[model samples]
Target: MSAALGLLAVIVLTAATGYFVAQEFAYVAADRAALEQAAARGDASARRAAKVIGRLSFMLSGAQLGITMTTLVVGFIAKPALAGLIQPLLDAAGIPEGATGAIALAAGFVLATLIQMLLGELFPKNLALARAESLARALASSTLVYLTVAGPLIRLFDRAATRLLRTVGVEPVEELHSGATLEELGDIIGKSQSSGHLPADLSGLLDRALSFGDLTADEVMVPRPQVSTLPSTAPAADLVALIRETGHSAYPVYDGEVDDVIGVAGVREVADDALDPATPVGRIARPALLVPGSQPLYGVIERMRESGEEFACVVDEYGGLAGILTFEDVAEELVGEIADETDAREDAPTTGPDGSWLVDAGMRIDEVVRLTGLDLPEGDAYDTLGGLVMAELRRLPCPGDRLTVALDGASGHGEPDGASGHAELEVVSVARRVAEKIRIRTAAAPAPADRPEISDPPCAAPRPEEASWTR
Candidate 1:
């Protein structure tokens, strides 16, 4: 009976080893599953299961150590008892009596090692990993009970281990430092959305809102050329007429060119003002808010929110007016396009056939670049078509000066039109230059036959000055 009891103890110890080994690694999968389930339905069972797995992990760790120690102690203390039981088996195999004890001891060690490694460690670990969620739930209460019993011992060992680890200059693991990346979080959110755990519209909105962070100010800002304004010295009646005609709430009050602008005037301020046809436009204008062309859209948004100002004049580095950005322009960034009743349909920039674009005179140069794959330099100097033309001309350009310009189709992956495979624009007519505002006519061909292929020409080289601006 003693021998039988000793055999049973070995079997129990082997099983304990396997269970502990499995419980340690299985908890991670169980915890993840529980979190996913919780996100969907707030599953109490899953939560309990996750708690159980955690406790089981702790208990299993202790049990693994305890079982090995207990096996060693028992092998030493009960050797004679175990050897006597093995003696009969050895006799049946025709082994000598003297060799029995040695053989029995060797066999005992081998058996313990095998049971601990195979059953205790590998087998249970695999099971837990494979069916982590279900197994964790089933064993949670039992695992918790075991942990409760071994809590003091576990804490003592844990404290000792922690101290030893610190002595060896090893810090405890910081799970947060190993947390998910943005892509991983995005994936999680996407998966949640796909699984119907979140509302589709809300998820889509969040995704779009997050995506808006990627856009630069240049991509979203109102280009300088599209800005409409009134002269600072214009008659109050004329200013009111301009306001009435344009239907814009605010207008920049410039003295000569837009670059020499003084201030801005809101229609709302004029709405209540008494009819004073002779009042100078500059006198009624508010302080102008100016920003560099290169300012970030997000920073601009923040500044606008804090400043309480509705209008900002975009300027180049040379202190010339490039364009203007308004509160309405920034609003379009967050919520797509905004069209009103007063907006001219024919004057709007429209997509043309064969990968070309027909931009309106009032369209922002920045918007043109975004829509038609045009590459323009960024600085405080030029922010619009008019500003760009003025900067390139150096001197004021006249109507007759025909200049050859290259459109950067390579950057935007735009296909060339009929004349040539290269994407380039030829200035046909210098339409008008009212102060800083300059309008030029462009030829809608792929590229001139004389123009070199984009591939043959070094892309790194600066764009050639196709035509000089003439007076």
Candidate 2:
């Protein structure tokens, strides 16, 4: 070929190689849901992009075929042309004619390889990855055309690959999983937050939504000990006083044992001025919604919605009342604490000068990790820091109850916080038969002599009225 024609051919071949590389990466990285949304908005290029991603295996095969063919053609055109162009320069430099050809060939090979790798491979691949959706939409039409022209070769390659995969006990998929797994979604949310691509509040809400379904009745409920109950024989008028104190809309009415709840009564049902005050609450109570403690939170929610009940009594496997699950608990799992005018918000965890934190027992383990950077192991049996303390103690904790232990992890709390090594978890306050406050620090448990004076409630923090299970 003439020198000009050969150089032009090499440039065109290199362009083709870049095209295939870009297409391969763009198809993989493009978000299918975003493309679909654009297509729904009448974007023709997005529609083509979606089609390209849907047949990922076949399209990728075509990309491989195009890349291989272009690279081969570039080598054939450029190497000889490069040799021809360099040999004369060698002649002009007083090199022996016999040595010129081989020297030119080796130099041509190196130059050709560098040209292909940098321009044809690396640049396009990175550009495609950085703007995957944009490139996919811009190039999908031409990619579809190329795939049609190379259908037979691509299909043959795909089938052979599929058969080879099956022989090794693997199944070839046409496309990658379109939806992200919960764990992957969590990682995405975290990275987005760290990169400032997502708002912090939205990141937290999305994270909670992804994890909410993993909670069961047991994980999400108010424990039975905190339940405020009325004897079924008590006057209906007592609900008025209870509501005034606790501000709950509903209560579970039990015949005798809380485990034997007859029904649930609402304060709204007993506000009639002329209604007899002595009316038995059980008599006025409506049918109770019952759910097993082990039941998935989703199942509990479905039962409540289906039965039109605001509260469901969570029962342990042995038929004891585990606690009450409320719609507020359900909503708060996603939107966070739903405090009203009557509700007192729990205090934010307080960190001490010695790197200790006076943490509320009700805080989730995940939050504790974020706040203190503690690598506490999560357990299926419990979901809070208080629960971890209970597990370590293996029993109910009292004030000054000390559990000394070595915990492994960095404790800088990602700030100018104290070092992490030995951790002492001491029950600083107990309320309603559960640990209410814990003092966590990287030091030995205080000897009773060394124990600092502690108020029963720790910080004079007002009790959250919602702790009463007017569930």
Candidate 3:
């Protein structure tokens, strides 16, 4: 073939290679959910794109075949053409008798490979990934036609691959996997946070949001001991006093025992002119909204919303009050802590003189993880640093209580890495049998200097508490 026609063929073949590369990546990276959404909206191109993704393995095989065939053809056409065109140039420069052909061939091969890789591979691949949804839709029809023509060959190749995979105990699926599990997403978020690809606060919020649905009322409630309640027969003045002292608007009024919660009373119930101080508190209380401790937070929120209750009384299996779950508790689960004017600034975690963190023992375990970059173990039995401490100690904590736990990874955000370290948790204060405040110091963390360390702490059996906290 003439050098001019050969070069044109080379250009067309390289373009074809680019088309397959773009199609392959675009379909792979395109958001499956987004494509479905568009298809639902009557976008014909997106409808076709969605179909392509349904047969991912076959589509990908066809794309690979196109890329390989076109790439080889481009090399076959371009090399000899390039050599013929360059030989005259080499001859004109040096009038070489033997060296011109060799020099021309080497130069032509380099030029063809560069053109094919840059234009046919890297550039298209990046563009396809960045604008995957749009390109996937744009090329869907053309890709379908190509695949239809190549179906027999592609199917044969795919069946062979499936056989090989099955022989090794690997099963091939039709579609590429999409969404990740929460644990996998957490690992990604952690790496992004550490690499500064995501800001710490936003990353943390996202991590919480992803895992929020998996939380239950039991995991995010005020423990029964920490919950303040009133007897059904308590005087109106008693209810008023508890409300004012705790700065909480609502109180659960129980019958005989805290477990037998009868109804809830709010400050609004205290404004009655007809009521006397000596009147029974239950007389003004509204019907309490009760929920199971094991209910998921989303279901809890739905129940609360439908019932028009700002809080729910979570009950254990035997129909006893376990804890009170408020909307604020749900909000805090996503946005970390929420403080109002009533909250004491002193109660917030602060740096000690020796660099230890003086934190509330009731602080959530996730918050503690973010603070110290230590991988303290987590289990269904506890969700707070205080709970973890109590679990490790096997008993409620007391003043100057200390325990050292091994770390799984220094990157507090992600999956456990092989990197090793440890953290020391010291109970700084106990109030009414609860570990109300503690000091935390961990190796490789910025907050605290070294503290006395206790290793693999032995836990004691949980004991009944003489409680103190309200709200």
RMSD of each: 10.6, 5.1, 6.2
Against the true structure, candidate 1 has what lDDT? 0.60
Candidate 2: residue 163 Cα off by (Å): 2.1
**1-471: candidate 3 lDDT, tens digit per residue:** 998888889889989999999999999999988998989999898899999998887899999999999998998888998888888888889857698888999999998999999999999999999999999999999989998999999999889989999999998887767879888988898889889899989998998898898888988988888888999899999988887888888888999888999999878889887779998988889999999999999999999999999978999989999999999999998998788876654444445556566677777776677765556778678888888888877765656667776665554454323224776787766767767767767544323422233453533433433223211
Alpha carbon lDDT of each predicted model: 0.60, 0.80, 0.82
Q: How far off is residue 102 in model 2, in Å?
A: 1.9
lDDT of 3 at 82: 87
Candidate 3, poorest ten consecutive residues by summed lDDT = 462-471
Ranking by TM-score: 2, 3, 1
Q: To one decimal, what is the Cα RMSD in angstroms of model 1 from the true structure?
A: 10.6
**lDDT for model 2, on a 0 to 1 scale?**
0.80
Model 3 Cα shift for residue 172 (angstroms): 3.4
Kindly list the per-residue Cα lDDT of model 2 for residues 1-471, writing each as its tens digit: 876677778788888899999999999999889999999999999999999998997888899989999999998889888787788899999998889999999988888898899989999999999999999999999988988988988888888989999999998778667777888988888888878899989987898898887888988898787778877998888977788899888888898888898888877668777778888888888888999989999999999989988899989999988899999989988887677877865554456666677777877776666666665557776788788877776666566667655555542233224544556777777776577877777654323223333343432333432221110
lDDT: which candidate is best? Answer: 3
